[model samples]
Target: MSAHTQIMATVAPSARFDPDLGVIMPPSNGMPRSVFGRPVAPLAKWRRRYAACLVVLDFVAAVAASRTVVALFQDADAGFWDQRVLGDTVSAFVLVANIGVPLLWLVILAGAGAYDRRALGRGTEELNRVVRANIAMAAAVSFLALGFKKDVSRATVAAIIVGLLVYTVFVRIVARVALRRIRRVNQRASQKVLLVGRLADALAVHEVVTRNAGAGLRPVAIHLPQYPRSGERVNAPVPVYVGWDLVPLVQQLRADTIAVCGPASLESYELRKLAWQLEGTGIDLVVVPQVTDVTGPRIHVRPIEGLPLLNVEEPTISGLSLLAKSLIDRIAALFGLIVLSPVLVGIALAIKFTDPGPVMFRQSRIGHQGKAFKVWKFRTMYTDAEQRLEALRAHNESDGLLFKMRNDPRVTPIGRHLRALSLDELPQLINVLMGQMSLVGPRPLPTEDDDYRGDVRRRLLVRPGITGLWQISGRSDLTWEDAVRLDLHYVDNWSLVYDLGILWHTVRVVLDRRGAY
Candidate 1:
């Protein structure tokens, strides 16, 4: 026997040491002990399935679009459908273009993040991206048509564009609904989640995961920090054990995946050591970020000389980014004004008739760079609600400088419902158009609020968003510390992709109507 094995055998006569679980206990001998028995490879399977679905959808959309274009022209000129033209020149061109367009579309879709599972069935953001990509593709095709002096009919092209848009959108919507249902079913069937972190972090992680059953994680057990065994039960619906016992617990629970939310004090060397030990095990390890509400696109992993370097690019909310935001805001606001005119008129009439005050409420709040700006909202509260604020301060449930009360008596009946569903914030689309706010950014804080701190004040770096990370991530239910952390995370890692995600999630959050007030 090797010296290390001899030493271990001598130290524990009847025991087998499990490196993953850090346990030096009795061996079950010929009896198989379940250690690290989860199906980690299944995630790869799911990814493959997801990619296949996307390819099929893309192909169908492309073929339908191409056929529609061909049919439109063929109907206009019956001679175009004949064996001579169709069999040779037209047939060859259509066949090549049909296949080429789908392949090119797949590349464009990948670049636009259309296939990301996290983005499936999210919102209009994905649709917007699809529209932009299709427009670019159309432009390219138009340029080719001009260069070649091709006799492509505008009606055919238009039909193809419309058909592709409808097909892609319909397929995505159906996919999202189906996936959500599958997730719900999976939760009911019980999937195991192995949580690896300090006790405190593990408990918090467990709470969130359990609360959101749709998130698809079931905490089977927690691997606590190394050292003296606490022999204490965790508050979660799972067992808590010292780090050394993790491997055996994983096998016992048949966990599908392991999520590691290591403590802030965890050393990189220790993490590497643990990773090495778990390398061959069929358990998938996912590292949870200490920072919350940050999107993936904002995080760049650079390998320099074999070391993984995490780069967090500072958000550029000014100059070109600001200009882009301004353009989007104006376009959206103008569209909203045109599309929601009836709704706006009704709201104005109701407010004017029900209350003696103006239909709109304009309040001074901190904007970009601590600049004061008047923020507009459809008036939902009594005109004297601000004057009555101090008396209701004791009822404030929000953790930071912000004030929020789910059951505030000062809220008018109309205002309460409006705020519940975020209808009160609709007028801010105008603020967005005016360049005082953005479609997606940090929530603007009132200058008078005492909660603004040193780093927290960085939220002003960008124009306040009508709907932001905060708005989607529990809003008033979030602690001040959590709120600030999320805002800073956004500032550290802002990207067009991240912004689109926030916008997409915002729609879901609004529809769910959880923690809104």
Candidate 2:
């Protein structure tokens, strides 16, 4: 046999030679026989367990929300439906809803793809699905009540739906956080990934994989289509393999995932053959697309004739969403200014008493479409802070356009606490109220620091924010490039859901005071 033929046979020993196609057919048995004695079951088992755990959690949340609402907000003797029509006892009707709602919740969650293994452990997609499911459940309840002409209390229904929504989202977030923590600490919980492609492409994909430890993909080895003819050294972090014998190697390593780094490196037939070899082995095949940075919602795969084409939708810069964002920002800002007025007064008084300067500080910042506006903040520095900037330039700790110092002499004692807790940023609500800023968007940069060119200028596509991806991500600890990248990512993937998520995390990040100056 030729060397290529011998390699092919080695790769798929169970396959029979096919005379028609001039190749081998996959094994007749459904499951491919592993070169090693045992199959990799942990990969599938753990995922099933995780999904089951989510099911249990969702069910619990549903029961608690419904029961608690019926207990507190609703009277126990009150029947959900009109007794004159259904002729059921009040207690019996209450019991039925308390029992039935949770079961229906699980069904809807499953239908909404909340328990899909792909979204179980990470990303906001899981939470998004959960939220969507909750909304659907609420609508379903409303429709049932109205269609039956049942005398359901609108207040009670609203309480139950709102309570359930809050509880489910909370538990899911907690579960995801716990799962990620476990995966980061325990390698066995993660999937063993075998990267395949050209050397450069494999290494690049490895970098991306390693960066997201929470993703549960542990790269254990790399496979090249052919040995390098230039005799270059293999410097990959994982063990490197070459040529065929892929099935044997996969079995030996017990890798449950085969990530194709660049499909362009492999011939179409070779890719198909690899897929054939992995059939029914429970090894996941992942293809890394050449397109980078774009999120899943924007990318749609359309099959034309026989070829699958990727269609990337344009980023939403203006639409009903942006209009909603604008309205929410202003209303929330106005409400915040009113609710926090007491705290705001106290801060102003403290600043006036201690610092003996203006209570508010405003500086020119570049906002949406490069428009210059004054960004407001509580004065957290001495009156002569600007004058001191020139001298402190030599002691600058930041590795970017912004100046940062761990312990600057300009900060007053009260300012230190304000800065740490991010209370100094509260007055920016005025900016949001004035339409100069948003609750969540790219952080506005000082006009003098506006070196924004190329793709970096995309940050100006939307209104600047009082707090944003950069503020919650690392604050001043992130380098200029990292900050810019995050802002651009937020711009490209802007959604109301994304904004709400950032705002939610901002509370925790503020309390933790991570990366705070």
Candidate 3:
């Protein structure tokens, strides 16, 4: 094999790796020693410290926010104590019963798996969970007020909970930012993982985990049980740990996690045995489903008498859910248009004055139910963009399905910034308002029905979105496979909560200016 092929076979897929006991051992296989330059910190210690720091920050924020709310109420309503909502005979203690609000809030968060080791540094899951936990806390507090004859001011309580939620989320986000810095500046803080699956499955899962170092899993080795006995060195990326004996190699490599990419390597029985082996071993077990790109909230595991089944709910397109989604799309679109009126006018003027073309660029795009509609956007490209497309085909920076090029010559100077910031698509709000699109759904591709295939065509079931999973997740930078997977997953498991989560992260993604081009 060529030298490049040899290295590709065993490149020691990275993270904080032990130096002396290197992954992809050279001598044992007669191959060159795989380069894993990054030094590693103990995964156990790093997780513990990060989790502790976040918990401490949460406590501090809770106390500070609750106290501020109390002080504000006291100042605004001097008669807050005397003007009891319950009755005249209520005690001061009853009115100020929320003195333990901080403690209660912290406890609720902890109980909700906010500080979970698996959850600590994962992408966006912790923040989502924290919000849900606080919302639950608010509901519980409201219930207590109604059930018990408490004299607490409902307005004051609501303000305090809302304030606390904001502070708590802010603290967690800051903590996450710090953790991300550590991972970036020093890769050694990441957890080492051993991947076990078929070659294709393992590589796919490894790519995802490697891309999301914020998730804290760094695969250092691959074990292909299905294709064992080829050689001491199985020709694959990362250190190919030969054989189905995963439990032993995990200990030998000091691996913190054993990620089963699919159920292929270890069958159901063997998986159970492996779990039994790892009992009390402190080794994390992560399973990547054969079904890809699905989010956590949609997956439900239930045991029916003696059998466990994984139930994935189909994406809701009918009933009250769809109605509510439609309602939200129109309402949010109208509000956005109103709020951004000046900015819209400015963009229109810029497009008209700079480029000798119409203010709005409307092009036919496949929309809901395989219907074609004109999608609206601020004209970022020149009037002759289509004519120049063939010449620029060679320089297409994005995956081939979507024609995207960074610093394309056809784009106006102002259009570069617009596309970078995703402000170019702001006029899609009109499409959203007209029900041709949604505030959040899969982006409608400009493909004919003849070109649309089986599962891919399912994207047409709902109105095309201005921004959805595709917009927040790397945009044009994602591989065609990944882009399709994300869009299909979103369409399959659409939820109001999931849509809001996407919208929230959309802000962060835009700010990061990553993969925007």
Clash count of each predicted structure: 4, 0, 0
Runs in model 2 lying further than 4 Å from the true structure: 1-45, 72-95, 135-163, 184-189, 198-218, 224-231, 236-241, 244-255, 263-265, 272-279, 349-356, 392-397, 407-413
If the candidates were sorted by their TM-score against the true structure, best first, what order would they fall in?
3, 2, 1
State the lDDT of candidate 3 residue by residue for 1-517, as single tens digits.
Answer: 5432344244333322222322233223333221122233234778788888887888788877766675667544332323334346555434353445667877899888998887886766787788888888888777876787555566777777788789988988788777877776677568888888877789888887777565567787787665443233345457664432565456657778988888676789878877776766678877787667566666789999978988776556689989999999999999999999999999888878887878888898888888889998888888899998999899987663678776789988878888889999899999999989998888888777767787788788878888888888778878877788888888887888788878977887898787876
Cα RMSD for candidates in order: 7.6, 7.4, 6.5
Flag regions of model 3 displaced more than 4 Å.
1-43, 75-99, 123-150, 226-233, 394-400
Q: Pick by TM-score: which candidate is best?
A: 3
TM-score of each: 0.73, 0.80, 0.82
lDDT of 2 by residue, 1-517 (tens): 7433453455456555433323333445656454345554345678888888888998889888877776664433444633333464766656665678888888889999999877786668888788898889889888987897766777777787788889898889888778777886775567888888888888888876776566788988777877555545556566566643566566656778888887566777867887876776777777887765677589999999988899999888798999999999999999999999999999999999987879999899988888888989999999999998999999998876678999999999999999999999999999999998999999887755357778888888899998898987779888887788889889988889889988987997899798887
User: Model 3: how far is 33 from its true place, Å?
Assistant: 26
- Overall lDDT per candidate, in order of appearance: 0.69, 0.79, 0.74
The lDDT of model 2 is 0.79
> Over 4 Å off in model 1, which ranges?
1-63, 71-84, 88-166, 181-192, 204-213, 229-237, 243-248, 263-282, 289-298, 449-451
